[model samples]
Target: MDAASVPAPASPGPATAPPGDLAIWFFILAELLAFGVFFAAYAFARAHNVALFDTMQQTLDRQAGALNTVLLISGSACVARAVEAVGRARSATGARWLLAGIACGAGFLVVKGVEYAAKFEAGINLSTNTFYMFYLSLTFFHFMHVILGMVILVALWVKTRQGAYGPADMNGIESGAAYWHMVDLVWIVLFPLVYVMR
Candidate 1:
């Protein structure tokens, strides 16, 4: 066969696979549904006790929440950059960007820990009041998700260093970055709902 007459096979990638593992979308959807229910409950509770929600909301550290918001946003952007680098087969650059993203996620955890510590020191617990119940419960739930996302990111970073991803092959990295973006998106909704909304 003439070289010019030979047809090239289609390269399966994000455009074909929806970015990442097909299975992860199930997990992401389940997680999102859970968060949606929680958010609905929060709205219900707030509706029933507007004054209490508003008062307790004030006790929360808006500054810390805001800081975490910025970190997650930045982290998500870095993950995107990392994905792009990986697509280009720039393993070193991709790994570096992933590390930066992981750092941002870790920073969020630290800021959240301090905020929780202060709450605990003040003797605030789920039983403290209704508003506190939702405040702590919701944030803690999202906090756990952040931790899980970081774990995923670290694995992706390691894989990137090993030359496991590229434009022709990126399911693993795409899936991990997708999950991390979900984590960030939830927080974007959460911060406004729990802190900024009255």
Candidate 2:
């Protein structure tokens, strides 16, 4: 064949970038740093009041904390599935997964709310001691993140149901999923530190 008639070898596709927007990753890093500082404060406080922390830890609703753990972890898994589905252009399936993830996050909030109610009923407050202070502040901080994460998931679900996300346009859903995973991760660490640690 004439060289001019032969096709050139196919060029490889462009390299894949990270799943989400660069801005979202930077936001995630900042959020993680804030959580890290909070965690370190908890650890430092606990070290100086080991006996008090241990005693107070015993009074916590271990079952409730454990349940919230399950709920958050399940939520994270559902979000992951949602992202995967969206990447495959299966918007309906992605919406379903996002809804499931939202439900899981809501369950966590409900369980944690009940736990807080009980604590307040028993007159527990930040003034209760160093332990309750850290427990309430740390967990509540995480609680707000969960709420924000759920909000992001809800938005993603709405857009996904409208066929907004797909392989060609994944930045929004991926960014929201990244933040939701961060919320789940902080809870995983908080549960052990504030609920079960000695």
Candidate 3:
């Protein structure tokens, strides 16, 4: 068929990333690197003082950490569902899932705050010991990430309501979801490494 007679192709629906923005990926990579350095330092310190780590680990509130683990995982799952919903052009449904995710993340923050309050009440701080320095620092850092992720999700939720996300234009929502998953993953690793290790 002549070019004039042939029809142009239709683009595929659903976006996989921030279509035109490479900056977010760079930001994500930088964030991951910062966390990676922290984790590596933790491992090094743990290796040099296994006894200290074990004794301190025993003092952690495993129940709270465990609960937070479940909460973050559930939140991640909800975000995943939201991505799927958005993929199907179900913006409202996706926003609903994001709301659920925000709730889960909030639950995590509350539980974590309680845990921190108890620690503070008991006079715990970064100067308490090397283990606690790592504990408070790691967890609090992750806590901040959750807060930031929630903010992103909230923005995405607002955008979705404005019909900004869909299979054909998913970059913003997907990027936000990706960040949330990364936050969840870090907690998954942090919880076990800090709370349950012996």
Q: Which ten residues in a row have the lowest lDDT in candidate 3?
A: 13-22
Colliding residue pairs in candidate 2 = none
lDDT of 1 at 73: 99
RMSD of 2: 5.5
Query: For each candidate, how many residue pairs have backbone atoms clashing (under 3 Å)?
Result: 0, 0, 2
> Which prediction has the highest lDDT against the true structure?
1
- Superposed Cα deviation of residue 120, candidate 1 (Å): 0.3
Off by over 4 Å in 2: 1-17
Clashes of 2: 0
Tens-digit lDDT string for candidate 2 (1-198)? 655897765886764456799898889899999999999999998899899889889999999999999999999999999999988989999999999999999999999999999999999999999989988988998999999999899999999999999988888999999999999888888888888879
For each candidate in turn, the TM-score is 0.92, 0.91, 0.88
lDDT of candidate 3 over 1-198, digit per residue (tens): 555886655876665455324667777788889988998899899999999999989888999999999999999999999999999999999999999999999999999999999999999999999999999998899999999999998898899888898897777887888888889878877877889867
How far out, in Å, is residue 55 in model 1? Answer: 0.5
